[model samples]
Target chain A: MSKHRLLAMFKGFDDSLPVLRDIKAGGCAGVSIDDVDYLSPIEHPDIDEILERKVNVQKFTFTGAVFGVTFGFFFLASAQASFLVQPQGGKAVVPFPTNFVLMYEMLIFFGIWTTVFSFLFLAGLLRKRGTLYSEKLTVDQCGIMLEVDEHKLKSVKEYFKKQKSIEIREEAVT
Target chain B: MEIKDKIIDENLGWQRINEDVIRSMDAPGKYYWITFAVCIAMVLCAVAAEIYQYRMGMGTVGLNNPHMWDMYIATFVFWIGMSHAGTLLSAILHIIHAQWRKPIYRFAEAMTTFSLMTAGFFPMIHLGRVWNLYWVLPYVSDRGIWPNFRSPLVWDAFAISTYLSASALFLVIGMIPDMAILRDHAKGWRRKAYGILALGWRGDDRQWRVFRKTYMLMACFLIPLAVSVHSIVSSDFAMSIMPGWHVTTFPPYFVAGALYSGCAAIMTLFIILRYFFRMEEYMTLNIMEKTCKLTFAIAMVWSYLNIIEFASTWYGHNTYDKELLINKANGPYAHIFWLMLFCGSVAPFALAFQKLRRHMPTMFAVSLILQLGMFVERWMIVAPTLSMAHNPHQWDVLYGSIIEWAIVFGSFGWFSLLFLVFVKLFPSVSMYEVKELTFHLKHEMEEEKEAAATSSKSKAGAVGKPGLEGA
Candidate 1:
């Protein structure tokens, strides 16, 4: 009984083409690669790098500016809110100075919110399709594999005989 | 044969474990019974205190105007702060790839759940008429007025509920497989209990797929909840107009303090679990040391904020803010103020050194001290400022009466008592994650050596053994 069962673990990838090549070579046996898993780590070294690489630096800064502007708006609104009552103030009653504290907080809060969410989104956690591979990949091993015609089995086996930890098996349908 | 030569050694070769290390159920001879009786008695005491508080109204707990939320608020904040250590250690550490955090995380999460339960009681009980507490929420009201969305109290309610739900979900999702493992290993009632909790989890591919997805989603959800919960708590104070209470920095500052105190509380519990549950093998020096580093860093942040807030008050020339700062530092409560600095600042800062951090007993002591100091910090925030208000004529000295003190003591007693019972009920260390980490670490180490050896062997040989080499 022979059914293609192959496991490959690669260290680094220069491009998705090599991975795509490996997957094509495997021909749908059982392909698992941690390349996407390590993408965040491999791409951004730290928080600063995360901010820099995604071209979100300007966006993140702009959000901070917007946060300050909104805080000012809230400050004026709340202050002017009291002005609507009896004994209307002669001049503006907005607490601009005290409101700066709120502005600072909103900026930091939004900063952390953006950074944390972006990390999750970048990791492909936001829109995960059915995982690219199966559950056994987590525990046993990870690789790309091909389920080929019985006639091609011997050739495929021979091809990967040189690589480390390569195995092939097949089974006929009942 | 001569008598000396004929004599055989008959020593039992027993290892000496710290008395604190032994589980309450498994205490050495008489101490076992002693610890069990004590823990049971403490649990009983807490239940009795709760009953008394319920029957006589919360006034029995010495809560009154000006000091409306004294010991309970302090304790609630303390317990909630303590809960942070577990989730932070679990989810954040998981994201950051710290293998050592796994063993400590399971119990720490349990601590979080129980402490949250205990923390929850305060808000309910603090509402003197606990029966009417449901009105605190928004419902299709007969009064036609929804609970004020603007009120920080409502936000606190929403935040705490969300946090508890999320934490419970997080803890349950993480524990399901482990519970299944327990189901397999257990017998009778334990087996049935674990089996139910396991929810027919059989480690199948489909089950794993869902489990992994749910776990990832929960973690993503929890990270924000963790930040949001503390921020909401801070909002309760910041929303107020009291000089010391109103500040934008409270949210982040409170979160930092919560994390700082939470880390220390976790350390205390971690060290206790390590010793008491015979978990030194699983918990280990590496885990404690990593926690020590986090606690030290967070403590520095907390101290920096404390100074900055004081500096801002002094610099801004806000008369009320300046007076509150002065009263906090040098007025009637100066002793606790300095003690807070000593425990939260100086003691933990010593952990900056690697050697001191590695010393288990020292780390344990420092952690306990910092947790106590955090309790005092919450007290200093709530009590002294109210006692020394802007309207000097209305200022009154607030002292915690005996009943208030009892509730505080009884809550700690409740926490410890619950913790001890949990240790007896379940394995405190996460067996699966720990085993997985150990396997990964060993495999990684072996892979390094094998890579070196393979390079050398490749020149001399043609084939390599594959299956077990990597496994």
Candidate 2:
């Protein structure tokens, strides 16, 4: 069956929170709250509760940092070993202290690139399908969009209206 | 509900902030175009001079055996130092949750990215054969030779490239949400441009969560990276066998000087941006005052380091170092050295007075003079030491030729042009961060009022009690 999507806009973050809470509560009453998304000009504190359910990018960051440290040391050590055994003056062939500088820099370099990679990967950036968005959401308004059953659409719209949503947009989703 | 409504409503509304900042991206006044044209002319002149120098060889710009590293290297260091204030200031302030940084950090970070780009050109220019510059990279070649891992120069290549990539990413990541704001408001070509740059930023909670985490992680990474980048640059001189250059204190000394000059540059740009963009409301007098205070503190730190460097040289009694120090004070460069003292050491004291700090014209002039001092300071570090090195027979005064002067002028113009284009393309002031600041301020005020009401209510209840002795 084709589903309906409802997008409700509110003037303030505080006003939007109650609507989001009610939408979550509505799911317990047999209404399919298939997905809920909150949009705002600035990140709102209440959004943290919803974010707990999303994929964590920090794990990727950890993995990247580990790889960076390991690769940094390995690259320097191997470079030293690859050169001819002609010791410059009385110094050691592999100067560990001096090599640490490049290794340190590489650690930061790899760590940053991996963090960026993970963000792009998990955030689903450069995706083919665009998200449901409203221009006003980037300005003074806050938005809540939900995919719900058609029978529950009227109740959802009424609930949002009662909660003082400034604008409500509805569209059919196949 | 009333409390929520009152707390949510702020003086600088989201719509107003958007309109004020995004207006600069619209058709700027005729003056902007004129300034832009002048910058382009300067840049072209610089490019012409570079081509001339390239054809005539390194001899066109005044380099000799003893004094091999001259104005190009000095200017390179100056620009690298100038780049430090932006990322260091933004990252450090953001980490500490300094709300005042919201309006200025965007431009400051842009400065970091552009100055690094400008600084990157110098080593190539100094290389004479700029074409073979990629030899510094550590790639395995058919010759089976690898870049020496022990060389500080190699360390510099790694540090600078890493910093450039990291800061550039940091800059872009911070701008995504703001770009999304512009994408929504813009039309035609602007819409397409911002839409692509915005990376489909939809302001979803999930995306923001990851963004904030990533941004914080980068900031944490950047603080150390910024410090290390300058330290490695300083190592270029410190690790050398030259007497005056081989000082243990050079790293910290260079870092302090870099921050000092960088802060001054930021003040210079801050005032100019305020005047041009009508951003007086955002870049208010109070913010300028705080910035001046920070600059003054850094100036004092740099001056302290300078004294320590001089004192240590005089006390250590190393013949080459002492000779260089004496020559710096009483040699042909004496006038420039004294001028550096006055500009770097004395002028920043003017900021100590509130009247002078708040006076835009006075502060602007002081910033320019301070930067002059810094430029000369870099020159002094290079020329005097090389001129009065261990072998007295080779000592001779080296000066920059006309080509060097043109390139210096062009570098300033190039930096300005990049900044101008950036301001036009992106919202120079961060839109969302500023809104966040406004919200926090409003919330704080509401909380204070509620606390006061609660205290008064309890006091009234106690006063009405019959058991009160005063009653």
For this target, which candidate reaches the highest TM-score against the unseen true structure? 2
Question: Which candidate number has the best DockQ?
Answer: 2
Model 2 chain B poorest 10 in a row by lDDT: B1-10
Listing candidates in order, what is each one's chain A TM-score? 0.43, 0.84
Per-residue lDDT of model 2, residues A54-168, tens digit only:
5567777777777887888787778777775654677676788977787788878988888888887776666654345688988878888778788878887887788898999
On residues B178-214, what C-alpha lDDT tens digit does candidate 1 reach at each position? 6655665557888899777766544422234334444
Q: What is candidate 2's lDDT per residue for B105-197, written digit by digit as tens?
A: 899899999999999989998898999888899876667777877788999999999999999999999999999999999999899999999
Considering only chain B, what TM-score does candidate 1 achieve?
0.87
Fnat values, one per model, are 0.00, 0.67
* Candidate 2 Cα errors over 4 Å, as ranges: A23-28, A31-34, A85-87, A129-131, B1-10, B469-471
What is the DockQ (computed on Cα atoms) for candidate 1?
Answer: 0.04
